[model samples]
Target: MDPCNRFRMFLVPFVMGIAFIFADVSQALALRCTALSGDDRYSILYTVQAMHQAKIQRQGALITVFEIGGGDPALNGALLYIRIEHNDQAFVWKTGLNVHSIQQLSTGPENTLDIRAKEDFLDSNNMVISREVSYKIHFYLNNDTLEDAIFVENSPKIN
Candidate 1:
């Protein structure tokens, strides 16, 4: 085997490996917001996280989980009024929970809310996709008065 040919073969694999590493790093650099909406007295918090899962005989998939909660220093066991609208779907909840309280409207508590997209959906080189999801959250006091209204337009991409 020629010495130059051997080096060329090794170089190709090494460069491919570096590209994959950079892609992974770019994905990790994506912004992640855990705080959604809040007011002077109360707040409506949200968290979004993604995880990649492998499937048998199929391309891997990305699963995103969403968690929403109500928070206030003066809640003191007071019932909170929360309304969440995702992609025009509405969910309402009233609870006396604190900041750590998480409510999953569509799915079970253990499952929570999630959006799944193909692993290849993201364009690594471009880094500009045309996919987005919208959300609206409203926080209210036990007295039936609105505390804060949060409207998110074209939030993080789903694809």
Candidate 2:
């Protein structure tokens, strides 16, 4: 091959590789996350709870929620930040507006997420004063994202 042809061949593949790299980066950057406004409501202690993917059987391929700063298993006022992965994209929703001691995490009806927990009634100082009620909150998972959560029980609003 002539010198010009050899140089052209090398340049073409290099340019193609660079383009491929940029495409992959853009795809990763396409993760759409909801507003994490009140994420600082909880303490810094976060515990990772990884669930079995086959059990849920939803649009999310992997689901993980980090438990934030609650020690007592009985009346702990813990918060959660959920992360869902689907189709190589990730979505996060901060479940931190209320005080909950997560008792169970499982699949709910209609392919939703079932988070069974005891609601902690906190005093003005963010201390758990009472654990009077339990709640079952359902998080709807769509094709590429998790929808707004719905809950039945009324808990003290965290500011």
**How do the residues 1-159 of candidate 1 rate in per-residue lDDT, one tens digit apiece?**
999999999999789768756754543332322223335113333321211221111211112222333222222111223343333333334322212222222221221222222222225563423322222222222233222332221214332
lDDT of 1: 0.31
Best by lDDT: 2
Steric overlap count per candidate? 0, 0
Most accurate candidate by TM-score? 2
Model 2 residue runs over 4 Å out of place are 1-55, 58-60, 70-76, 122-159
The models' CA-based lDDT, in order, is 0.31, 0.48
